[model samples]
Target: MKKRWLCLFVENEVGVLARITGLFSAKAYNLNSLTVGTTQDETASRVTISLFSDDQLFEQIKKQLNRMVEVFKVIDYTDIDIYRKEIMFLKILKCTENDRTFLFQFSEVYGIRILDFNKDSVLIESIKAEEENNLMLQLLYKRLDNPVEIVRGGSVAVEAV
Candidate 1:
């Protein structure tokens, strides 16, 4: 199965998000990543979803979404050029002075930012693709000796204009 991307334009109303997610759960279709936000019109919201599925299943998924009354449009982004990014925050606790210095340098090498730091802890932020974030998380887990905390937001994407 290959990864797929889809964007849905739907009415901005209560229970819409739940009903959409519920459909996925009831059908046993796995959602890799999902994000929803209101559009400039305010009456509608854009829902960006990613999943791993075969071509046939992906087509079925699109048809099902289109059948929903709340959905205004369903755009398949799987074969399109788009800009996508996920936000991640990684905090390292119990850091030493040396570790803090090392982290600052490390952030410069990677595209990560040193968001905040104290004598004992440092917070790093990264806004990048999901695969890149995953690799960074793995590297941090392997390299950092201090306790760590992570917060990740679902990916958002926009098609190339």
Candidate 2:
């Protein structure tokens, strides 16, 4: 299976999101990430979805999406050289003094923006390529004492040169 990021443009109407998601759920397809919001055209919305499936299944998914009444267009970025990135907000809930020092150093190296901090936890926001998110989480897991909470803002992309 391969990872695919698809952008779906649909009518900005009630239950449209639900219907689209329902299609995936009903088919037992795995949706890894989803982000939906209105576009400049307030009448329409852009829904970005990331999923893991083989090439054949991916084609079927696209056809199904296009058949939906609400969908205006579908943009599949799986094979395109595009500028893709996902936003991640990580909250390091627990760590030692040594861990804190290491985190600060890591922040400096990675250019992480400190969103909040207190005696118990530290929050930082970052935007990076999809694969980079995994690498960043790995480093945090190795250093942090407790499980980290992560909020992923699904990937957005544009055409690259």
Candidate 3:
């Protein structure tokens, strides 16, 4: 199976997001990432979804989404030139001075930001491609022994102009 992406333009109405996600759940499609936000039109929303599936399954998913009344358009992004990013906030607890210095150096090298810090904890933010964020998380896990908290804002994408 290969990764696929879809951008769905749908009516911005109550239950629209639920209905769309429900479709995936009902069909047992595994979603890798999903993000939704209102478009400039305000009356509509753009939903970005990423999943891993075979070509046939991906085609079927697009067809099913197109059949939804709320969906105005379903753009397949599988082979498109697009800019995509995922935001993640990682907090490290019980950080020592050396640990914080190490984290700052790591962040500088990776283009991550040190968002905030206190005496014992530091919060950092990473906005990058999903795969890059995943790799950062893996490296952090290997380096940090303190309690860690992570929150990721799924992914958003726009077609390259």
Candidate 4:
């Protein structure tokens, strides 16, 4: 099995997101990430979903998605090379002075920005854009003693890879 990104264009309706997600849940399909946003046309929206499946299963899912009433189009980016991005926010506790210094340097290397900082902890953000892999995120996770809290945005992609 391989990871695949499916970009679906659908009507921006009240229950569209639930209907789309329900399909995967009912079928017990494993979904890695899901992100939805309004498109240039206010009546339509773009949903970027990530999942792991083989070719056969992927084909079935695409067919089902195409059958939905609200679905305008479905693009499976498995074969095509597309640009991708994921944004992450990390909060590291202020346990020691050394940690702060180290994290500052780490941020500099990755070009991540410090969103906010206080006596208890620091909040940082990392935006991975036009990237090929998750090496930066992996390194961040391993380097931080362990973040007090972490929040990662869903992956979004566009343009040709």
Candidate 5:
């Protein structure tokens, strides 16, 4: 199935989120990720949601969303133009005197900053979510001999067209 990202503009009111999510549940659509926050316009809020489905079903969902009284705008970012990004943090196995230089070199190449460090692990932050995935893959292949943890933030999107 194809993944679609959408930005929904809706009125700021109680149960607004529940009503929106209900529509998807009633249709048996699985939501991959959802983030809702107040927009600069105080009267309205923006919701960013991602889901996987076919074109036809997605169209039906869009139409139903429009019928909701709270929905002000439903922008299918996957259609016209959009930018989507995610965030992740990597916790590498603690640094050793022997591996400190190697860690620094790797971090420099990837432009990753150390968010926290201890003898047993180091926390690195990457703004580019895809890059983090690639980095993890590379580390696995290289057998860095270090433990790692990843914390991922869901995808956020903005309309471009």
Candidate 6:
């Protein structure tokens, strides 16, 4: 199986998302990530979905998606031109003089922003998923006295060419 990303342009209507998701579920296709929001054009919305499936199944998915009434367009971004990014946040263990120094160094290197902070934890946000994971790993290596938690947002994408 291969990972694939699709950007679906659909009519702004109720039940559209549910219908689309239902189709995937009925077909036994697992959606890795899905993000939907209104597009600049008020009449339409864009849904970005990531899934792992074979080439034949993916083509069938696309064909079925197009048959839906609310669907305007379905673009297979994995094969076409696109730029993608995933967002993530981590709540690190309690801060200390040493932890603060490590935070500063890691944040500076990865361009992470401090979303929230307290004596017990610091929430750091990053747009790059891999970078965020790497930062979390590095912080864990230092071993703070407190525990840490990670939260990730879905991937977003746009055509690059």
C-alpha lDDT values of all predictions: 0.94, 0.87, 0.95, 0.84, 0.80, 0.83
For this target, which candidate reaches the highest TM-score against the unseen true structure?
3
TM-score, candidate 6, is 0.87
TM-score of each: 0.95, 0.92, 0.96, 0.91, 0.81, 0.87
Residues 91-118 of candidate 5: C-alpha lDDT, one tens digit per residue: 7775675565666677788677778776
When 3 and 5 are scored with lDDT, the better candidate is 3
What is the C-alpha local distance difference test score of candidate 1?
0.94
RMSD (Å) per prediction: 1.1, 1.5, 0.9, 2.1, 2.7, 2.3
Candidate 4 off by > 4 Å? 129-134
Model 3 has an lDDT value of 0.95
1-161 per-residue lDDT for model 2 (tens digits): 99998988999999999999999999999898898988999999998888999999999999999999999999998888888789999888776667667777888898788787777677888899878888988887776667688888888876688
Winner on lDDT between 4 and 6 is: 4
* Worst window of 10 by summed lDDT in candidate 5: 128-137
For residues 66-158, write the lDDT of model 1, one tens digit per residue: 999999999999999999999999999999998899889889888799999999999999999999999987887787789989898889999
> Alpha carbon lDDT of residue 156, candidate 5?
76
lDDT of 6 by residue, 1-161 (tens): 99899999999888999999999999898999898999999989999999989999999999999999999998988888777777887788767767877776778876778887766567888887444566666765676665668787788889886
Worst 10 residues of 3 by lDDT: 135-144
Off by over 4 Å in 2: none
Q: Which window of 10 residues has the lowest lDDT sum in candidate 4?
A: 129-138
Better of 2 and 3 by lDDT: 3
Which of candidates 2 and 4 reaches a greater lDDT?
2
